[model samples]
Target: MKFYKKITEKSKSNSLVVLVSEDTDSINFSNDSVNLLFSESLSNEDLSSLGKITVLHTPDSLYKNFNFLRIICIGVGSLEEIDSNKIRRAAGSFGRYFLDSKLSNLSFFVDSIKSKDTDLITESFFEGFFLGNYIFDKYKSKKSEKKDVFFEVVSSEISNIQDIVNKSYEKSEAEKFARDLVNEPANVLTPTELSNIANNKTDKSISCKILSKEECAKLGMNAFLGVSQGSIEEPKLIHLSYKPLKNENSYWYIGKAITFDSGGLSLKPSGSMFSMKGDMGGSAAVIAAINAIANLKLKVNIDVLCLATENMPSGSAQRPSDVVRAMNGTYIEVENTDAEGRLTLADAITYAKGFDPKFIIDIATLTGAASIGLGKGNISAFSNNKDFMDKVKLAGDITGDFVWQLPLDSTSKKQNNSTVADIKNTGGRLAGTITAAHFINHFVEEVPWVHLDIAANSMTSSNDGWHNRGATGIPTRLLIELAYIFEK
Candidate 1:
């Protein structure tokens, strides 16, 4: 997909057309382009009723006289409702249309919206369209191939906004990289393969370091390595850093990268294990968000940490009574090997503490309790610091990530009382998510920290507004926004 600021009328002869209902400063539809109307033919009342889109397609044989065959009218729900997200949805709707119709090329005209500043909206649509086309196709023979996509901005003066347009595309590219990594089968994307992806992609702006099993043992990451011992694939503790030349305050983000969660000795049924490939989604989100910040050259210092491993059952797997030392030197009694995300997060959080960052935010598909609590609607946030959590909430609000802060210092903390070791892995059935967070909280100690239990929101079993099924990539934009907040 390529995005250009201004496409001349000559460019329209060979392409399918997309037109906006109205004309604006930065986008102007050529006469040859399809006219996207708000209503049946683009009336004021029709625009109000058309909440999302109105599309048309012609027979393949009549491709001449302008292949203006396919016309998609996107509804802004009146001029007042037009925003970046709506524009993004407009893009997604376009992608879905192309997939359904098997169309090859699309030329979009950005002149419809009333906003004079069409630059950001145009760019955002392209980004959203490209991202919405994402599918985990590694195992499928009927994989969808990339089609030629063109976004043509109709204004001559807004060409300088190409930077934002290009940045959005770059962000999408990094997101796709993370998506691909998350979608790969567990056999192919072992801890070793994860480290290789980091090594191959790092540059001066982003520096990556990988610690193998032996190195992890040397660093006292026993709790993390204990879970990895059951698998043939070794565990990797990954640290990826991005620093700007003028950064003032640095922040670190930790991702729990459980490549595959098999419930260890307490094995999961075939249904649960099938989608376990996405267990690494938290790791993917952090890396993808950091990759976006680096690509945009945001003036901030950010470190991304991923504890990559697979949780399986074997003779070598840790038992329920086993106690292992963490990187922070805390002893953890393994009550259930299936409760492994917090163990890996403990090591990653301990490692991140080395940098003495201003703040730490850790993301993970930590527990099913989160789903039980939120019901796949919103993310649960637990924070030790109120001000920092407020800042994070503001960021989420701005980016539309939508997080709800749940109490961490609830009765769940008392429920984690372990008589044998420092702390127990699982705390009964009630408030399981909060108790798991308390378990990880032991490692975060004095730092201003926020933990996002995204188990419910990170991936969906069915299609729901704005987000379809599979990895939601829930909080990437929120993380990016948080980085910006800390930079200031």
Candidate 2:
């Protein structure tokens, strides 16, 4: 989807998208027809919700002077409280509402939009609109008839237009890439298949290296390998790097790639295991974000590591109370085979520490306690440094990927104490999310770090324009913005 820019107060359009608020008395437009259309829309539309839209067919007799098939007025609630998020949400509504029709293009009226930063607001609008318009019908026999919709945005306030253009394209395409990967079934995207996909991403702009199971074992990645021993699929330790001409900073990203988690010997109930194919949501997030970062050509050095494997129960699967030593020489007592993602992530983080990055950020769908604690549409954040976490929170706020920090005090660390090994994998039921973070923190060493537990927000129940029924591909935008913040 491309957004062609036209800086004008008025234009002849077939289908137009306009912003509306409850207190919308008038918009100071150079064209009187726009003002009249706004007034007409306010009279008929209800401003009850942020993403609500009122589609009105203007009478041709009264509006023969201007060319328009219909006017779409999306609710933004109040102008005083308007922000980028509201704009994105309202834009999402616009994107999702046009599913039945087929069209080449639409126009958005951003000339009169009230915003603190025109670039930020315009970028947010693009993000919301494109994301909301997304649908995962790859497996459907009959796909959607709607062609890829392009937009012509009219805005006098949009300066530095090329930056918005680049970011908008990169961000949306990156998200779509991640969503498509997550939507792929486990049978199709096994560990080797995922490694091939990662390998294919390499070019002059980026570099990718895949380590075989033998290579991993040579480095004493026993805990990481233990989780995949039951499955016949060969585990892949993928390392992707993006190095610019001048690197201002360096960071590492880790993702858990359990393509199909059957919970091993600790089997999940059939009902709970239905969507286990999305267990690699973290891998998608990390991989997608790095892809965007590299494509945008930001002046930063970054490394992305994904430990790809499957956790299937078999006669050779790791059993209860089994002890496995991590690459960091820390022994882990596998109390429950279901807690397998953290096992893979632990060695990945330890391995990442070898490169001596200035900071490390890992994202994963690592815990159900995250969803139970914060519900859906929110990310659970944990970090050892407040400043780093604050920057991540700012990125989340900028991107509408809401991140809520959880407690990781010393008390949470005590839950993982083990009688036989250095620590146990499962830390009981209480504070499960925090304990999981604490367990991963054990391998992060002294680096300034933040862990994003995206279990709650990675999958959605409804197929809104912004989210599909499965694999929401969250924190991709958030992580991209985090790299941008680091650049500044």
Candidate 3:
């Protein structure tokens, strides 16, 4: 999707989108018949009911006078309730409209809405439209033969919307990149393949290094390696660094990139194992967020790291009751082989802490309890530092990626205590999300850290809001917004 915010007279898209609020009365057009239709339509029915869309097709005779072939009016609630998210979801439906209607392009025009916050409305429109125009038909024999889509936010009310559109495009495209990676089949997106993708995408501002199994073993990443021991495919510890010319602060982002989670010896049922390909959603988000940060040229230093592996059931696989040593010298007793993401994260976080980052934030699809607790669209966050978490929460809210903070009580930590090792992988059925977080926290040492349990929101089953079904690309925009917080 090409987002050209300002459309010139010579470059007019065939389809036009008009936003309707309670305050909207008449939709003005140079054509008298077009104005007449809208005026009569408004008198007969209210077009401002939130989420109500009224589409009108041009007749054959009016084709000469009709500047646009089709006009779609999207009602965006009352002016008081108007926000970015509503605009985002509504604008996002354009993708479906484009595919179904076979429309080449769309020009967005909002009425008196310009008197309010035009810039934010502009940003939300582009972000939503950009993000929503996604389709994962990689495996389909007959893929969508979609040409370049032209999206122009034709706002006479604002002059600076073009830059916002460009920025939102880059951000949304980064998320789309991650979504494409997460949606890939496990056979195609192995640990080695994911590492190569990371290495190939590194720009001049960023440097990427892939650590092999032998190197990881030398670094004492046995806990991470132990998870991949079941599979013939090799594991990788990918470290990507983005340092500004004038570095201000240091930050670390670690992700659990389980290319496929077969539950090791404690295998998952067939029904539950199908979507396990998305186990690497966290790592995809990390890579995507860092790419956006670099593309935006954010002046901050960040370490984007991933522990990529696959947890399969085999004779050599790490069995239940297996004790693995972390890079930080912490011992973990794996009572359930299904709880493998934290083992990789345990070793990865331990390795990241050695860099003495200002704060470490690790994201993973660590537990099913997260889905049970938060349902499908919210991210369950646990953090040791309140102030950093507060900033993270604000970022999530700003980007329309909802975040809820869960308590990190010392009481929950007790559930992870083990008889043989320092801690156990699973903390029983109760407080399962918190226990998984607590297990990852055990490796954080004294460094301030936040753990984002993205299990629930990682891969959405449907195309809702700005995301289209698989791989909601959780926290990609949130991470980009986080860089803004520090930039300020």
Instruction: Name the top TM-score candidate.
Output: 3
* Candidate 1 colliding pairs: 38-42, 52-75, 54-73
**TM-score list, all predictions:** 0.87, 0.93, 0.94
Candidate 1 lDDT over residue span 318-408, tens digit each:
7877998888878888888899999899888888888888899999988888888887757889999999999889877655566888887
Clashes of each: 3, 2, 0
How would you encode candidate 3's per-residue C-alpha lDDT over 87-200 as one tens digit per residue?
788778765555656677777774446536777776787788788888889999999887666766665656666678878888888889988998999999999999999999
Give the least accurate 10-residue stretch of model 2, judged by summed lDDT: 1-10
Per-residue error (Å), model 2, residue 269: 0.9
**Which is the better candidate, 1 or 2, if ranked by lDDT?**
2
Model 3 RMSD vs true structure: 2.1
**What's the TM for model 1?**
0.87
For residues 368-388, write the lDDT of model 2, one tens digit per residue. 999999987678999999999
Residue pairs of candidate 3 with colliding backbone atoms:
none
lDDT agreement of model 2 with the native = 0.82
Error of 3 at 449 (Å): 1.3
lDDT of 1: 0.74
